[model samples]
Target: MTTAVAAPFRFFSLRVVRTRRLGPSLVRVTFAGADLAHFHSHGHDQSLSLFLPAQGRTEPVVPIELGDGWWQGWRELPDDVRAVMRSYTLRALRRNPDEIDIDFALHGIGPGAATPPGPASRWAARARAGDPVVLLGPAVADNRAIRFRPPEDTDLVLVWGDETAVPAATAILEALPAGTRARAWLEVPHAGDVQDVAAGPDVEITWLTGGRGALAEIRAARLPRCERPYVWIAGESGRVRELRRHFVQERGTDRRRVTFVGYWRRGLTEEQLRAAGE
Candidate 1:
């Protein structure tokens, strides 16, 4: 059921090949399909839209045959029958076998959770081999979905992300060229959630366990003096907004040099956030 939607983006039918628990709060799901032979991306913070099967269904219901009109057609499906679509970032892409890895942050799925697990979380937690899904992703190597672009003249790279953004943040670090000067702050809910990253010698990474908030810690720390520093931050919407303000207003960094994405809001689901045009 693969179909071309537009240039550089299309729908691909895929199935889960395996799932691994990265930590108490994360699960890594690997998917594969013949359509993946056409899937390509530069891979730094590459965004993806995943369509999951409705509860108790084995396959997702995506109207890929409609091509450009698939969105409208999908929306017209019954609420309980339509596939559940969620935004995720590409963690890793592989060839030969044609596979992609997506890391899921299991929000509210653990012990003593304050909230109930969402559909995505519940699905990822229970996903097994051969579970059918569909992905809307890039068909070209250098697509616009990647948001980790830094100016050529940049002297230093600054990165920050919470658990939800770990996969993207880590991918960006791994893709940095040798000798690139970079510093990163990755915040996770539990100490066990910190995974080892293979960054260049010049890249310094600090794993922040739940503690003083990211904004407070970042403000208290001193960054190396660099004339052209580029910043990338992603996490909750309210925190992302505050971090952007800190860099642009407080640190005097050029607004154009900073990239920030709010992966989620405190109280809003993806549907609600999109409806409000966030």
Candidate 2:
């Protein structure tokens, strides 16, 4: 299945209340607003669509005012006025304060740099307190985009991801029940990108720096014996596919029990990737 399933999505205007660096390449932006009170998110790998404005613009130009056919209306807009849309995981949600936290991975200009400049990365780098943006997310708590649902009879959980998928994987780790057995492999561009993650007692996490030999590393690692293991993997498109193959073919995992998603592709912008249906 795709990374995000259909849900009743509504636009919420969120203003950045705070921003901080979580690591060498990660920035945590906290948002709050009255409209956020209607924002309900189910925590395990819950995804949201962020609409960012053009450089120098204060807010995204969302044509949601057009009608229920907002997506079509957005496409009809002039290029300069249309917002830049990107999908991100809901890192943390606090209902009492009407706030949400999202972790952005900055690439190209800092430690663990990779690309030249990206729309989301540029916006994140320049975002400050009080900056406003729009998000398309669930209006209710139970939504299909929250895709960390393991079978009720699951015995073990296996997860893998690169830096881009860290926040979602972290959320999944946090949601695992106590005494649940889980093993996670995370790949980041630099050693400093690895942050401490809190999870259940039986969770074992391995962090790989630079992601140079991550495929080989995971292939060499052995999974714990379990009758019904639910596996999740996400990251760069090529690597994600390779790891999915490792699980399905090499490890003999049932394809139906594995959930794999390609968060991004190396050499393509979100626009290009989406256009090509990657």
Candidate 3:
């Protein structure tokens, strides 16, 4: 078996300063602490790992010394005592206040209300000012989690995702160079989940509301003609793979120009999914 290499990211103990409902099924959590000054966000589709406190706990249990052995150390912790880890995208980063904003989709409050709470979602829903959590993030701005990289000569950008991918898509949109052409399709749980997106004047966003199959909709929708269109997609694993196929096969787009991320699977928990990959 090939052991996964330990990540070089730094760990920070951040406290939730505030939380607010961004839309029907989105919560924006603002975290701040002295350690945030070391956090460097690359801006586009940047992902972070949050080590959340276990259920009924107030503070996350994290290692005091984190380095090459951190991954093994965390894995060796007893199951019941280990903090729950989850990945999230950075929505916004502010330097003056030394804060980072993360948006969480309220997966527990809607159609899946009766389902057991996901560790991260549950923590985010109940998160309040002063609540502490530990984050594994970048000390340098160019760390690898920011995956939305379009080629320099690309003519246009195509973006798509479900609610879980919205923050990243929006961030990618906002980070585009001024006047760059782009089109995005965001799938949310409801119409109310749509928020104002900041993008260049040439960018257009289409929000896909309830029951709209994002992959099917994108397949049938008319895309603006472009000689070199870079595509970025993230969401359910199956759909993302299918979308990737469509872009590279049916659409005949260059394989290198399309980036697809399977953020989650429908029936599997994040831990299960990660184990399958390992």
**lDDT per model vs. reference:** 0.92, 0.83, 0.84
* Stretches of candidate 3 exceeding 4 Å from the true structure: 1-8, 111-114
Ranking by TM-score: 1, 2, 3
The TM-score of candidate 3 is: 0.93
154 in model 3: Cα distance from truth in Å?
Answer: 0.7
TM-score of each: 0.98, 0.94, 0.93
| TM-score: the better of candidates 1 and 3 | 1
Off by over 4 Å in 2: 1-7, 112-114
State model 1's lDDT: 0.92
Q: Least accurate stretch of 10 residues (summed lDDT) in model 3?
A: 1-10
Residue lDDT tens for model 2, 103-168: 888877566355686888888987889887888898778787777778889999999988789999
Instruction: Assess the local accuracy of residue 79 in candidate 3 as a C-alpha lDDT between 0 and 100.
Output: 77
Local error of candidate 1 at 103, Å? 0.3
Rank by lDDT, descending? 1, 3, 2
Q: How much RMSD separates candidate 3 from the native structure?
A: 3.5
